[model samples]
Structure formats: C-alpha cells, structure tokens
Target chain A: MTRPGGRSARVRDAVHEAVVELLAAGEIDAAIPKIAERAGVNPTSIYRRWGSRDHLLLDAAVTRLRAKSPIPDTGSLRDDLLGWAEGVERSMRDRRGQILLRALVATMAPDEEPVEYLRARGDDLQNALDRAAARGEPVPTVDEVLDFVLAPLYLRVLFRRPVEPGTAARLVGRLLTALPADPAPRAGRGG
Target chain B: MTRPGGRSARVRDAVHEAVVELLAAGEIDAAIPKIAERAGVNPTSIYRRWGSRDHLLLDAAVTRLRAKSPIPDTGSLRDDLLGWAEGVERSMRDRRGQILLRALVATMAPDEEPVEYLRARGDDLQNALDRAAARGEPVPTVDEVLDFVLAPLYLRVLFRRPVEPGTAARLVGRLLTALPADPAPRAGRGG
Candidate 1:
C-alpha cells in the first residue's frame, strides 16, 4: 500500500477535499489556482498530477466517492450486489455525492467532457464483478449490472425519488433473478 | 373520434411542430413570440392555449413524441413489449427526439422544472402495461418495466450507445423472465 503518511498522499487527500468543498459551495468552475490555494499545495503539483482543472475535479469526485464505498467482498453474490447497491444509494444521497452525480449527468450529452470519467467509475463495478467471478459464483455482466442496478439508482437520482431503505435490496433481487451467474442446471450436482 | 381538422387542433399541431423545430435548431430558450412566429400563429393564441412558455414547451415535446409513438396494441404482452421498446429506441434515435430527451435529462436536478414532464412520459409506459392487463395477460409492474426495459433503453440514450435491433428483444426477454404475469402455477389446468 502507498505510505499513508507520505507528503504526496497527504497532498492528494487535501486537494480532493478542497475540490469537493468548492464544488459544494457552487464553485463548479473553480480554477486550479483556487483549488491549489485551498488545498495548500503548489499549482504546479496539481497541474502535473491531473493535467487540467476539469480532470482534477472529476478525479477528486470519483476518487473520494470510491474511497468512501469500496466494493464489497461478501462471499455471496447476492450480498455483494446488495452492498454495491447500498453504497451507490449512499453516495448519491450525500451532499457532495449529489454534486458529483449532477456532474456526471451533465456529461450525458455529446462533446462535453470525455467519457473517461464514467468509464473509470465502471472500473469500480468491474472490481466487484471480478470478485464474484473469482469465487466461482455466478455473476451478472457489467452491462447487466449497469442496466439493472446502476440505471435504477440513476433514474431515482434523475427523478429526485426519495431513497427508500429497501430500494437497493429490491434492485439487487431483480438483477439476481434476471441474470443469474449460471442459469443452467449443473449436471454433476447431486442432492 | 376527435375532430382533427378543427381550428383548435390545427393550432395545437402547428405550435408543437414549431417547438420541436426550434429545439433541434439549438434555440432551447426560444420565447413564445418566436415560437408563435415560427408556427405562423398569434402570440395571444399561444398563451391562451398553453398559458405559459414553459408549459407550452413541455406540452409540445411530450405531445409530439407521444403522437409519433402511439402505444403498441399488438394483442400479445411479449409483442406489445417488443413494440414499445422499439418505439423508445426509435424515439431516442431521432434528432428531435434526442433534443427532447436531453431536455428531460437536464431536469434531473432538484428545481429545474416540474416532474410532470416525466410523469406524462410515464403515461406512455402505463398505456402498454395497462393494455397487457386488460387482456388478462400476466404483466410486470411499472417499476419492473422501468428497471428492466425502459432503464436500459434510456441508459443507452444517456450513454450514446448505438441502437441495435435486438436491444429491445433482449431487454424485454429479461423483463418477462424476471417479472412474469404469474410466476406461480394455476390451481388446476387440463391440457
């Protein structure tokens, strides 16, 4: 693991924190110099790290969101999916997370920011999927999860639907029933 | 049947057509006067009919999109679903439909506009769902169709995914399997 006390790691945490704070304060177009000043890091370091202000904003939002909700490693695929769904529900409910979700929604149109932000978010979902597959568990494909789980979460986000407690469970249940790991019967299995 | 050639009906048609044209031409903020001019109608009549500019825009977009797609009544739940899915795919593929979809997505925030715009669109889905039930066929709940079929279709709209012919069939297949009209067997049935 990267050294937690390292200056570089501390700087990254500070910069990301500043980005979220500024975004919450409605500084969606906050300049890099402002972010650097808020984070107490050199502008040069931020530019070298993220290449551009937009990149840094997207990175901060996604990185922090992912960090807060690491993909679950529950032994059961059902539990794993439920955990993943709850984490997404929690993320969108957060004030900062709402800002991030809006940011992602804004990029739904063509020629906005590059889609790498969404693609990078896909990696988190993939990590959960790969974990299920590695344990010889049936796993839904990435697209299925997106369609069944993520789509509903985001649709709720789109509609400003209040997140109910059982929302994630219901979504995961539907996904499990629809796209079972290996839907076919196993010939070698005996009762 | 309603009179299609009535003066009021003609006015409504012209105004809706004008709204869609203006939206596609990148005049998202086109005022009522502009819309009236484009439709070759009086501004007073536009306000008299729609009451407000925002109302007119929402009414026009939803009306035109719904008009272009009358809900399918193919006499079978499966085919009806397939037809409904294909209609959604076709709508989002259309240039004007894309504009209206973007308009809807932009309202994903807390206070962008009324949720009635989306609710009106939801009526289209309900029409198909209602049709299935009226025929004594098993049917998925509104949420099931939203999560399974409509979610993926709209997700493609969000992600700019290409429209594949099998996309609707695939989505409908999963929905049918996941949420059958009656998953349990009848008490008694003779062949």
Candidate 2:
C-alpha cells in the first residue's frame, strides 16, 4: 500500500530509506553528498532539512530500531519480559539494527532525541511491571527492571556479543527470585 | 624520581601521554601523524610500535581508567560495591576520563582489545562477589553483579547522565534485598 502523505513526507521517507540503506551497507562515514546522491535528492535540501549528518542518521536509525520492537502483553510477566528481550536480541542481530545501535552508542548526546528514544523503549518493560503488580505478582522497581533486564541486553549488543539462547528466561527467573518470598498483601497498590 | 626504562620505553611513554592528551582534548578524529607530532615522536616509529591509532588510544586510556579503580576487599560487600560505584562515577566525571570513554565507545570493535579491556574490568566485581560468598553472604552470580551494579552505572555513563549521590548505595541495598533470606552454609564451596 502506498503511504498517504504529502510530497515533503514522501521526500523525507526517500531520504530515510537512503540513510538506512547506506548505513546497512556499513557506510557509517558516508558524507552528505553521498547520502543525497543515493537518495536522489538535492544535497542542499538534505543538509537544510537534517542540519547535520548525525541528526539525519539518528532520525532514520531510531525509527528503524523502535519500529521493530513493539511489546505485546502476553498476560504473563514472564512472557512479556521474554518477548521484550527477544525483540531486543532480534534487532541487535539485524545488520541495520546493529549499525543503528552502534551509531546511537557512539554519537548519542544527552540533549539528543535518542536519549528520549531509549527512555521510551523502556515503556514496554514498565508496562509489564505494572501488569505484574496488578495481578498481585511481585513487582519490581523501574531501576530494577532496567538493571536486571534491559542493561544486560544492551551490554551484549554494545560488545557485539551474541545474546545466548535462554538468556532472557534466565534473566526473568533471576528477577522472580529477586522478589520477596512472601507476597505482601496489597503490595502492588500505591507502589 | 628518574624513570629506569630505556629509550624505547621513554618513547612509548611519550606517545601514550600524547594519546591521552589528544583524546582528552576531544580530538577524537585526529590523525596518527598529528598524534605523533603532538608527542614529539617520529611518525614511522609511532606506527610501528602501536600498530594503529585505536590501539594506542585504548592502551593509554585503559591503563588510566583501570589504574584508578582498584576495588579492595573492604570486609563488607556493600562497602566494596559502593566504593566501586563511586570510583566509576568519579572516573566518568573527569574530563579526561570522559573523552577516553567516548573515544572507546566510538572506536570499539568486537575484535578489539577494548572488549577484553571491559570484560577484565569486571574482575574486581567478581572478586568482590567471591569475598561475599566466602563470608557466607547471599552471593549473586556474575550476571547479577553485571546487571545489578555495573549496568546502571554504565547506563548513566552512556547517556551522559549524572550518577546522582546515594545512587550507588541504593543499588547495593536493592542487590542485598534480592539475595536469599537464609544464607546457605558454605555457599561458595561447591559453586
């Protein structure tokens, strides 16, 4: 299906596609003229629209990375956590995803949208935690969720280490073990 | 005090110092000839000795980053972990340290020594865990140590977020809470 958008939107999409293709080809050091040539767009327009190569790359890359990992609530925190972790691993395994994540790691600044991009990616984990609490299961803090689940995954990606099979399940098991043995009454309420 | 090393050693030291200085100055993309010139060393000699720019920067940076944070067994895992966290935070806060870390993140490849450099940095944490086990404390696994302690600190570093005061203690407290309630006898013996 053709995407319904204005001419400018179409141009943007073309440019983004070019960015992804070039980045996927491992042309991380590709200049603006190269990207514009690949996109068949004007170099001035590309520079005027994106301002910097970093911004252009980040915009396209963040869209790709975030697009692949939509967390579905499977009605079980274990399932949800596993799904999230698996999605992360799958993204990391993709060449485009690898380029994007590495570029994000290398070029990300505190002021950049990638910071917000990363924080938004945490929503699925947060949702899972909230669901667990709602069901009276042991709920972990946001910090715990980040450290126990997300951090290890990102570390593996950063190091280009293959996230071994069963890693997610093991992480979830550890999270469960970390919870209080005797579930406190109404523990999830107000926490 | 006069250094006892020979001429080659002195040349290596000067080159390494130049690496740190250039990295700290945020000249991350600086060329090899520039670095050699800055170090007052012959460019050919520099290339022959260090093999590549990345190696030179990593050798110097890893030495500095690791040398400062020697995690001593402080009789309590909490104290030890807290000390380690604080050391990491301190290193990250330093301008020179910040540049080194950024360059490392940028230039790091899966096959590079920085990967080993990072893994080796975890030895201190592993040592702390072993000490905890020896004392019959509810010891965590290497994964737990990486996730619980190192990950959060690294996340902050990666995002350029300030590691707020008390963050380290809070992380330690959470890790302690996550441990089994009744410690097993001689937990470290068989494992």
Q: Which residues of candidate 2, in runs, are more than 4 Å off?
A: A1-13, A109-115, A123-142, A176-191, B1-13, B110-115, B130-138, B180-191
DockQ (Cα-based) per candidate?
A: 0.28, 0.36
Give one digit per residue, the lDDT tens place, for model 1 in A20-77: 8887887867899999999998999999999988677767766776665566777777
Q: What is candidate 2's lDDT per residue for B33-149, written digit by digit as tens?
A: 998999898999978987898788777777677765667678987788778777766777666776666666666763343244565666667788888878978776665666676
Best by DockQ: 2
Please state the error at residue B98 of candidate 2 in Å: 2.6
- CAPRI classification of candidate 2: acceptable
User: Candidate 1: where are CA atoms >4 Å away?
Assistant: A1-61, A111-117, A180-191, B1-11, B27-37, B40-56, B112-116, B180-191
Chain A (candidate 2) TM-score to true chain A = 0.75
- lDDT, residue B115, candidate 1: 57
Best by TM-score: 2
**lDDT against the true structure, each candidate:** 0.71, 0.71
User: What is the lDDT for B152 in model 2?
Assistant: 72
Residue pairs with backbone atoms closer than 3 Å in model 1 (clashes) = A138-A181, B138-B181
Interface RMSD of each: 7.5, 4.1
> How many residue pairs clash (N, CA or C atoms closer than 3 angstroms) in each of the candidate models, in the order given?
2, 0
